[model samples]
Target: MHHRATTSRRTLLTVTAAAAAAAATGATASAHAGASGDRRLHGLISRMSLEEKVGQLFVMRVYGHSATAPDQADADANLKEIGVRTAAELIARYHVGGIIYFSWAHNTREPHQIADLSNGIQRAGLDRPTPVPLLISIDQEHGIVARIGEPATLMPGAMALGAAGSRSDARRAARIAGSELAAMGIRQNYAPVADVNVNPANPVIGVRSFGADPQAVAGLVAAQVRGYQAAGVAATAKHFPGHGDTETDSHYGLPRIGHTRAQWEALDAPPFRAAVAAGIDSIMTAHIVVPALDAAEDPATLSRPILTGILRERLGYDGVVVTDSLGMEGVRTKYGDDRVPVLALKAGCDQLLNPPDLALAWNAVLRAVRSGEISEARLDESILRILRLKAKLGLFRDPYVSHEGVDRAVGTRSHLAAADRIAERTTTLLLNDGGLLPLDRRERPNLLVVGADPASPSGTTGPPTATLATALTELGFTVAALSTGTAPSAARIDEAVAASAGKDAIVVGTYNVSATSTQRTLVSRLAATGVPVVTVAIRNPYDVARLGGQRATLATYSWTDVELRAAARVIAGRARPEGRLPVPVQRADDPTRVLYPVGYGLTY
Candidate 1:
């Protein structure tokens, strides 16, 4: 969709304020910058060459100067030549439209490092005669997935919040996440994934989605949109139509879904509609194929029927539509190098995101324009929308947020407190035997904790661990910590269980990752002992479902410090279990079915 307004609110207000100031000298919106500001912004974007215009549509990856950057100096030089150096050079030479930060190249643990990198990028834009700040974005969807390393704020993933069964809780979580991103000067957040997580076997998007119930997911998606927008950050609802049904990861290969247009409209489009109604600034297309929607074999990124007929026409969403990384295997395998920019433009996408090769993509777009493959009108449309978004973010006229902004807002107690609050509300208990939980204070049953160190040495866990030993200790449970690395060995789980023998109750904590195997054998073995076993799925409840219902379960959906405390509170009866099942729990034997349907949760 093209932008309807080129005149920035800031510029218009500044001009008006300036005129008023000349008459009386008191500051007003018109006097802030005014008509002159609008002209400057417009003129600068208009004066760019076709090459620059093509460049403006290309968004690519830029690794920060942190530990993760490639170490070889020559390779670094090549990256710079490709416009990966300073933000100023990127705009001056390539005129690239935006950037997606991969990871910090060195010591990325400190929040200050991220702030510094963002500041430098913003400064580079200011160096231009007419500054148009880059559309800097990050993948900070909270929970198991986050790009920012330690010493950064991490919240539980969407699944946990969805389980909370409160829209306000989801909004609070988003607000905290957005505030953290905005404090660092980032304007775009590619998050609040609207995918309905119906398939338990889904390799991805389990914890990232709000939940499987259409109405529940829609409500939470709206809250997340409201939270990010309220804090001045652009929120994008992504993988349009849906990516939750597929068993394959688009990064690895293309996944095909048999859903017809009607099926998709009924099952997969509710959250997106809710998100758009809540005013999401952008929508990203998924790479999976729905033959019912588009049979041309093109993914949503290049499918006119999917991107235009469905998204734009049926949904009435006029916001900018961004493509999922063009570099992903889904598009690359079918279209090759030249078709990326060309097909996405034809599909109505306003931005070509995360192209594998920027220079190649630039030429591809330029060639398409010269050969009449893509009209000049199409180019103008995308740039106009990009410019409008920049103005809306107050980036076109003035791109600076003072160091005070960083100091006053980032990591503030208010935001941290909000995270903790959401964490407490989102934890859900999936099973209980003989009212074993909310243990009676008089009994003083011996307690045991059998998971890895859930704390980050700061006495807090993040978006990953839902319950920590220290948090359990605060609940008056005698806690002992056990370490579970990326994947635990069978002996490790057995040893931990053996140590807990003869205890009043057995609590087993396990984390789930897509590629890692779930310990069904270990869980079954423990349940066989019949010693009142309680399993805490500190990652995805789906992890426990793998055990075939042999053990009782609690679904935290994360193991973060805050979530850990929330889970412990639920266990000790300090808090009521309000969260419902966000996604269906499926058993391995019945791989094609669900063991626990959505909305199932136990309460005292």
Candidate 2:
């Protein structure tokens, strides 16, 4: 059952030579170097213990700004979860193959801090007995889910890029983000969300997905994959088999997709196929269940029929397959914590990401291997994929990155300018009634900016209202701001209405007005004030359909500062709104009635 015995020498040489060629020239390898590289990989695999091989399949998260010297809160969280005080200690204990960074976990504070943390983590892994390098990774999707925030270059999210309808822009954004991540010693990015948002009510992937059109989403996903890999970072096409049509968030519950095999092929399969064609380094499995693919109704993360039959055999994707975070309720609901990792591996996932209990999960897998529940060859197959990816990334040669290059590579003025340009292009002017916008700075000298500043997935609100106010102020207009909160109280709405008095114009930022009555009420009351009202849909463009009033409206698709500033520019006539709706917005009361069709936009 040894890998060397099972894998033909010819196949080994081919793989090793390809990896070497990729590292040396980023091209196909010459046959001369194949034997040495193959020998090295085979020798390493033969020498690896069962424990060491099992450890290679896990990607764990540790709470800390510094891997070696964790702060008190970080230390406590790490100790409680993994029985360790620092990332180094956790890695030493578990021999984890990768580490995922999170801002809430304090793993990414800033550019320099992230570089230091990544270097420290790498040192720990290299110091291990087997001397394997860790794959440092982050969400870094840029707009909403960015773990490494500004002064890291924040690009527009997938939907915004879709709105702008430029594949070149998508590629450039991914390359810029990937280069910055690579400069900080991070090798993998879980980004370019491949899910096509077909269902408008989908709570988790609203603005995260590229769009509802399968072909369009596929094109953008492919572009991002090439872009990230071009910059020496692995790009992950995520939530495989698609999580775009479900109402429930996989982080909370397992939603079932009712797509028949034919429907799924037409709607959800294109982006994944495009990603594979683009040579993506990995594909992350979703926790949602699709009965059409598997009769047992197992989540895609634990279904061999879906992962192996559909993704592996059907799609011909040979890269590593990573599962979505196992800590999520979706995966944990069916099985015990110990069994989830084993099930996922059996289902053909090569990497188990963010298992809530690492020790328990690791031990379970080790026991499964020893008990012959999982064959040695099966385990080795996954190990080979993981190790090959590490080698392809040049981690075997050198895993560490320079601290001096961090500042130069991240958030340069040129990168920031690119972000602004892209963000400006994504500002869709959905409504510009009777020349209400391009507000004359002299006529509308005083402006009031008020409404919901919804917090992003990272729990940082751009305080979008304040950001918009600041942007308007910079355009020679006196602006006052009030944050009515995502779900504004009655008192908050009244205060906003009272404050709108005597203002030359009112700009309201709305976040999902269909869901929040208070936000709709806030907009309605503000419109009653008779000041020319301009509504900006900061998160999703669907708010315009629910606002119940004819006014100047813009959809930025996100509440980030870059997006807010772009909205301001369009209002001041500094920049023309060029973005169209990427996805159709249906009327609030009627799903059949399309209020705004895809590619619909109004420009001055």
| TM-score, one value per model | 0.86, 0.95
Cα error, residue 306 of model 2, in Å, equals 0.5
Residue 582 miss distance in model 2 (angstroms): 0.9
- For residues 1-604, what per-residue lDDT tens digits would candidate 2 score against the true structure? 1333224333434445545444345335555555455556666677677888888898999998898998998899988998999998887788889999988898878888888998888778766666577898888886677787778888888999999989999999999989999999999999889998988889999899989999999999999999999999999998999999999999999899999999999999999999999999999999999999999999899999999999999999988999999999999888899999999999999999999999999999999999999998899889878877888887766677786888788989999999999989999998888888899999889999998866654423468888899999999999999999878899999999899888999999888886557888888888888888899998888989888664799999888878888889999999999998999999878879999999999998
C-alpha RMSD (angstroms) for model 1? 6.0
What stretches of model 2 exceed 4 Å from their correct place?
A: 1-27, 30-39, 456-462
The top-ranked prediction according to TM-score is 2
* Residue 450, model 2, lDDT: 92
Q: Compose the digit string of candidate 1's lDDT tens values, residues 93-178.
A: 66667777655333134566666666666555444433346777877777766666434556767898888888887787788778
Residue pairs that clash (backbone atoms under 3 angstroms), model 2: none
